[model samples]
Target: MIYLDHAASTPIVESALNIYIKSLREDFANPSAAHKLGKSSMKKVERARQLILKSLKGSKKDQLIFLSSATEANNLAIKGIKLLPSDRVHYSVGDHPSTSEPVKSLNSQLVEIPLLEGGVIDEAKFLESLDKDSKLVVLSHVNNQSGNHYDILSLGKKVKDKFPNIHIHVDGVQGLTKVETNLSSLIDSYTISGHKIGAPKGVGALFIKDGVEVETQLHGGGHEFGIRSSTVNTPLILSLCEAITAGLEDVITNNKKVKRINSLMREELEAADLGITFPFSLDDTSPYILSFLLPSISSDIVLRHLEMKDIYVASSSACSSKAKGFNAGFDAMKIDQSKHKFVLRTSFSKDTTTEDIETFVKEITNIIKEIKRL
Candidate 1:
């Protein structure tokens, strides 16, 4: 299958897979054990941690906690802060369910920031939502569906200037490897998923700024510096480290290539007269993901049609698409449901090529024309 669903989950890189297998065979020991074997495993985990820290450009002193997925990282980031009685939470309505759902579950006051039609959080609305009680603002550095990029530096500085005490937690799941992040200067807590960066699933990380106190969600052997408790998965962590290293090595060149492909896809779709809505201004979006509205067709139908042709894509965030009558993006952007019944998200990986995008555009145009005839 020609997979255009990198945002949903990327195919594991061969290097990451090889490392995963080698580690499982070679370093298979409980990190918590006291024996030499255990110490060996512990050393591998620490080395993996160093690789992750380096990829993020984070300080050695910064806290990096491993979790099962980006969803878990987001939960820890949101709930950990809500433990404080004075902390009010603000998150964009357009955030993935991993973020918005967790923030919604918190007992703390939840403020929803509106997004513009371009799927960007309205900075003015975001500022208006902040108050003295607002201790944390959770924003996605790049939206999962629309790929719209946020000005995290400006937003972080603005929030800091106004509240001084406010903390900004950025969900960087979509941005990792696709965009450059200077964690030291931009954010307090950043969430990343291994699967999105061509690593195996079941491993992710959260970057906690130094001096930030967050209560542990898990209770056990007090692993992860008591921030999270579980036996560290050394093999998966090593694989993740390998993936990150490989991703970072060629990120700049890969990103430019993806952008060029996306531009060509858009031009082709427009030429074919397909109804399209480009959410973010091209200049303000990431190259990896492109979300558009297809008028007069249901997203479900489009997805199924594409699948039948051995092409894979997504209608929305994988989690929310499963829910009945969920309209997270529509609710956030106040988009008219009738004018846009279907949302198609095409995500590209470094391995994707211009020929692949051209085929996708041609196939999709044919599908649209057939639907129009009906």
Candidate 2:
């Protein structure tokens, strides 16, 4: 089967999986326990923490809080902030529901920044929406729906320089390993997940900038520096570290390959004369994901057609599929309302191949013809 939903999750690499199994069997002691075995487990966990910090280019002062998934990290980031009725919380309407849900549920006041037609965070709109009374701005390093990404270094700096007291939280699940992140000042927190980058599901981490204090969201054992209080998933943490290392080793080469695959697919689509449209070009967005606007057919139908042929893709974020309303990205991009129900996301992983793209293109071209005839 051809799986093109890497944005939702990826299969764990063999190296990472092997390490996870070994740790689960041998290093099963509780890191918090007061014994030699526990001390050893604690040491391994710290080592993993160091590896993760290095990936984010964070400092020793920065703390990495391991959570179950990026959703939890996002929740912690949003709900952890101390908000008043007068203090406004801000984020792009196009962000993953994980980012938007907590803000919607927990904050009394919210200001949603709109995106440009090309799926970019509208800088002018953002500035207009932001106010001194804002408590935090949640930004995604890579938008989950559309592949268009943000330059975190510049954007984070821009936000902080203008609003010194306001906080910046980044949901970097799609961006962390795909791009270089030099965590600078003013960026208060970042959320990253393992599954999106070849690590196992149910493992993610939050980075709290030095000197930044977000109130603890979960309570119990006082673990994770009191930010979260569950017993650490030691096996998954170690596996996540290994996945990071393995992902980085091939990141440069994989990016080039994915870019080539995108070009190939675009070439085929253009040649086929389908009315399908893509939100952004190769250089403008991520090399890993594409949101294709189908021609006169619902994406759910197309998805099922592809799946029956042993191919897999998504209509939108798997997390937000059941949520009512149109995708914020499409609405922001001003993709025609007629095509709204037909947007399907095709995402790639490091191992995705040219043949896979070719096969998907051929099948989609045929599907378009079949639908047109009907």
Candidate 3:
């Protein structure tokens, strides 16, 4: 089976899986409990948090809160900030709903950042859009659909240089462990998903810069620095840390491998003359994901045909796959509305090989031919 939808979720790595099983069997005690085992669990969870923060180059004083998913972390980042109704929030329309929706929920005036020809953030226009009223700027480190890598470091520095008080929050679900990252002292908050790398689905983390005050979104026994309240998921946290460590260790090498696979997939598909057109520039986007348009074919039809052959791809983000019509993300990227239904996305992982791309291209070519005949 060829699974090309790593952006949705990746299979847990072996190291993470082992840690998860061992923790589940041996460290079942709740971290909140006052007993000795609880203290041990709490220490493990804290160590995982510190390890993750250090991996991201975050400062020791910075707070990393583990949550159920990146969606929840985005919510905490957006809603936790104290925004007046008159303040303005800048966000990309192409960002994941987890980030966009929360920014919209705020009563602040909304400014939509524009995307350039290659789906990159319009850096000049974005910097010009900032002002004293721009209280928060929410951005995606990597676009989930188009795979465009936003240079948060450069963007953050520019934003901070111009408007020192404007808060910058980044949704790094698709970028974590997949691209070069340095938290430094520019970004205010960043969100990460465990499953996007090689960890299980039930864990994610939010990094809030030191001195950044975030209001409590979930109230309970004052867990997660009193900003988020939940039982410290020790097992998931440990596994996530393990996966992160492994992913970061080989980021450069794995990225080079994935780039070859991505380029090969595009070459084979384009050579097939199946009327495929790439939406974003290959050079500007992350090599891990590639989305293209099919010729007069509904991607859903081709998706089903591929499924029958033990292959899997995605028509859009897994979260919004079922929703029909008017994809704000596509629109923001200048993708024609008429071609929305024809968009097909096939994302890869470090493990994806040249053979996988070859098989996928061959199968897709056959599927298109069959549909044309029908």
Clashes of each: 0, 0, 0
Please name the candidate that would achieve the greatest TM-score relative to the true structure: 3
Whole-model lDDT values for every prediction: 0.85, 0.85, 0.92
Better of 2 and 3 by TM-score: 3
lDDT computed for candidate 1: 0.85
TM-score of each: 0.96, 0.96, 0.99
Output the lDDT of residue 188, model 3: 96
Scored against the true structure, residue 194 in model 2 reaches a CA lDDT of: 92
What TM-score quantifies how close candidate 1 is to the native fold?
Answer: 0.96
lDDT of 3 by residue, 1-374 (tens): 99999999999999999999999997899999999999999999999989999999998899999999999999999999999998999999898999999988888899999887668888889888888888999989989999998889988889999999999999999998989889978999999999999999989999999999999999998999898898889999999999999999988898898999999988998899988999887788999999999999999999999999999999999999987867889989888889889999999999898888899999999999999998
> What's the lDDT of the predicted structure labeled candidate 2?
0.85
Which pairs clash in the backbone of model 1?
none
Cα RMSD for candidates in order: 1.5, 1.5, 0.8
Best by lDDT: 3
Q: Residues 81-169, candidate 1: write the lDDT tens digits.
A: 74455568888878788998888888787787777777877788788878889988899988887788888888899889888878789
